[model samples]
Target: MTDSGQFNSELMAFLDASPTPFHAVQSMQQRLQQAGFVRLDESQPWQLQPAGRYFTTRNGSSLIAFVRGTAALPEGGLRLIGAHTDSPCLMIKPHADLYAHGYHQLSVEVYGGALLNPWFDRDLSIAGRIVVSADGQLRSRLIDFKRPMAVIPSLAIHLDREANSDRTINPQNDIKPILLQGGDSSLQAIIAEQFMAADEQLVDYELSLYDCAGATLSGADSQFISSARLDNLLSCFVGLQSLLASDASHTAVLVCNDHEEVGSVSAVGADGPFLQAVLGRICGDQLDSALATSLLLSCDNAHALHPNFPAVHDAAHLPQLNGGPVIKTNVKQRYASNALGAALVKQLAGRCGVPLQSFVARNDMGCGSTIGPISAAKLGVNTLDIGIPQLAMHSARELTGASDPLRLVTLLTAFINSVAPLCVIAD
Candidate 1:
């Protein structure tokens, strides 16, 4: 197989393992550990030496790692790649206990920007981290009640008649997923049995309902991917691969954050101190200098203008599949990139001989933001937001170009390894 073919295979394998945010971070932790990276917890004291590789995790969801450069922490600063792990899905609520209309059901609160309609009538499962009671202490356990377990059956067309033409879903009333028969069991009871924990110890959980079906390669020659949480996981896989591939003279870091889809305010989010804490420990007093010249790349998925919904996107800047990576910008600073950040990425793309695309939302439509703005604000660093154009963003099965992920990795490797500074452009 060719190099691109090889990357495609590797990426699909990575995506298959990461169905939930917890799984995404755990899988990443394992990969980094195998690559000679030592694990460090934030609560413990850190003695990071030059040329060492260290990592830390937050809430078992977000992760940050740093590879010390050949030289001492440079005044020119650190190079960071950031991506989010949590995707839009139905989250099981605290009072998740319910038996609605003769079926055992789990009350779920919608998390992030989910395309709600796609969830209807799909076979679903529950997966995430659970805090279980254990001998007067609580332990966090990762669980995936993996099976064709739950579903939300849509209303029949025969009943509504105009279902296809004009139907609207009320999330509060219509979107709850049916799990099992009445009086069969409680969700907590089932979870305790799955983990072999005491019924009393499985006190609470932060679980999300997910599509139970396997993610597969579709289209002729398997050129397309159909998966449940590709919106951001695709970026996570690309960023981690590029970080591993990078050989930078400056410190190289990759941050996979959780809770971005809902507002990014959690301890594991970009807005929190997770990234800052890692940098402070790595650079210490040099943290200030690092922020002065440091650059962050917020990698996420951008929406490609659908051919059928041409009016919804900016007519002139329609991003397409197989169109290479895109430099996302917003006049309102929704995306943290200015002309300089975007140009810097363009230069890297050119150096790598890779194609590049640009994305701008329709003037009237509200644009989506990434970790770029939050990271920049929190660290006061120079940052750029970039991504691969994708369709069905926030949907159960998001789609992207077959070739774009590797292209992104290539561009990022070039950027991380380059010593050139990002030149600021004046209007």
Candidate 2:
């Protein structure tokens, strides 16, 4: 078992290093390589061996890492854990250059369901993938400004008296971040300078503004973690740690998809063919048999009961900070948790001696979904939705109990190592 303090320190470093999905995948790939997992190229033929550790990525964003167990895959099946890498943020527009009133700014589009108010007046930086035409060939590279380069200042109260109560943000008119005062710098020039590509031509790019501040242990007793992209990144870290710690007796897979904050319909997203393609290659002729005994745990942060907004949550289903992992369920099938799947998690939690909680939105409020249902439908596997309870989800900065992530890691590690059959027989 990992020490709580050590686990959180490593997690904070990961959050600080990964500002976008590309960076997150890169960071995870490096860690996997260090742990002896061989990287596989999608275009090349694979020669998998029993007990071999391997991983592959799609679009430099989504990733799938697995360990082929000594046991037959069709008999023991796969222990799968799923999470996403993308988060809600302000994405740079193609025509990003804007100048008004002697101020240079960049036009940005709101990506996903972001809490706009918190984004105001925050020190922000840019990081993402950029395509460059260098040496007479096109190449894709990741870049990060690595410093506070811009800010979105809020309108003064004198300008909008109702700013506190009924203020509305126009994505087009209000959110352009100020880059400099009376500067002649173009976005392309800035990118070239950052990349040191003096002779290369900037072809295209995908960039997003992120909070310059890094993750930290917060609260008086340092009981909570405050950071950006904790919604799913936290799950990704936990899944990776659990996979790394597995005993390798059973097949274990960790998949981190991209674009979940949006509708997850992209080529590298959960709704796409990424995971299916990987599974088909791994299982081959026994794909159906393997899926019948496999289980997927979709881990995404759940909304914790907020003390200041208690009325917004169902009284009976109020998940608490540091209370343990939460099993999310919805009758409408927004989440993929069924009775059998939920029961399996419960049994696992009990065996691991980890506390557990349940969450259901207020009767009048609609519930959100995760990759659980999508993966289950795509592969015909039993899946459950679970996550650590969190506060201010989709905000520029989010919060979760410092201990909950470690608790989840413990449970998932057990699940990956367990040799028992993962299915329940229905009478």
Candidate 3:
């Protein structure tokens, strides 16, 4: 296959492999480790040196990996790129058991800004964290109940005459997915048996409901990708591939955190101390300067204006498919990009002859945010938010530029390979 075809295959494989946030982090860890990156455990002391590759994970959902620069700790700082693993879905709630009209269902709370209507009548499955009893020991595992499992079917328009004109979902009542058709199909029992923890109590869970439908490449020429959870996972895959492929003298870092859709406040989220802790351990005492000159590219999917909804977007700055990576900005600071970060990316894109675009949400319309500001503040580093323009963000299936991921990987490779001097004294 050609390079583009190869990339498409790889991307589809990635999406298929990463069904949940936990799975995403695991896939990244495996890739980096295969590329010769040593795993670093924070519980143990870090003895970082130049020319080494190291990484660490948090709560099995967030990850931070960095390549040590050949030069000494730079007074400037590290080059960091960030993205998120989590997406909008329905999460199973604690005390999740429920039965209605002899139908078994799981209580669920909506996570993030989910387009609830699209989720209805879809082949939904359960995925995320689960604790098991293994040989009398409790262990946590991520599982995808990978089947045509549950669904929250919408009421027929004929039954609810005004369904099209006025319909709102009630997370507690209307959105509970129909899991089974019998007297307690023993959903919990099945989970316990699979986990080998039938004897143990179901202490807790953070499972999310996901569409089991596979992502596909459509169009006569296969120019379009349609799938769930593409809003940010596409960026995660691009960043991971770029970071692993990079052979730069300077350090290249990729951070994938969970909970980005729902305020990002979890322990494994960008708002948490995951990135900072990893960086601090890696840089040791020289972390001061290592953070000063550091820059981050917050990679997430940006909104592409839809022809049908042209009025919602800015008339002057319309982003098209395959246009290239977008440099996102918000006057209200929803995005963390500043003059310096924008200039640097643009200059680098120019130097590499790669096309670049810009995105600014209409002033009247509110904006969505990424992990950029959170990381910048946590590490005191400069950051820019960037992405490939996409349509159907947060929908059951999203669309993006066919060649955008490759373009982004190219620009990121350039950034990682570019050199900056570092001055330091070994402690």
TM-score of candidate 1 to 2 decimals: 0.95
The candidate that wins on TM-score is 2
Give one digit per residue, the lDDT tens place, for model 3 in 1-427: 1277788778877887777888888888888888899998888988877778888888888888888876555643577889999888788887777888888888888889988788889888888888756456777877887887788888888899988788887766788888887775666776776654445766567788888888788777777777778878888888887777666577778888888998888788888877777776767788887766778999998888798989998888888777889999887778999888888888889987779888888878898999988777777777899998889888877887677788888888778777642222236
- Candidate 1, residues 337-409, lDDT tens digits: the string is 8776777888888888889888989888998899989998998888888898888888887777788888888
Cα RMSD to the true fold for all candidates:
2.0, 0.8, 3.4
lDDT of each: 0.83, 0.93, 0.80
Ranking by TM-score: 2, 1, 3
lDDT of 2 by residue, 1-427 (tens): 5699999999999999999999999999999999999999999999999889999999999999999888888889899999999999999999899999999999999999999999999999999999989789999999999899999999899999998899999988999999989869898888887695677999999999999999999999999999999988999999999999978899899999998989889899999999999998988998899999989999999999999999998889999999999999998888999889888888989998899999998889997889988888888899999999999999999999999999999999989998788988889
The residue-level lDDT of candidate 1 at 247 comes to: 71
After TM-score superposition, the amount by which residue 225's alpha carbon in candidate 2 deviates from its true location, in angstroms, is 0.3
- Candidate number achieving the greatest lDDT relative to the actual structure: 2
Point out where model 2 deviates above 4 Å: none
CA shift at 410, candidate 1, in angstroms?
0.5
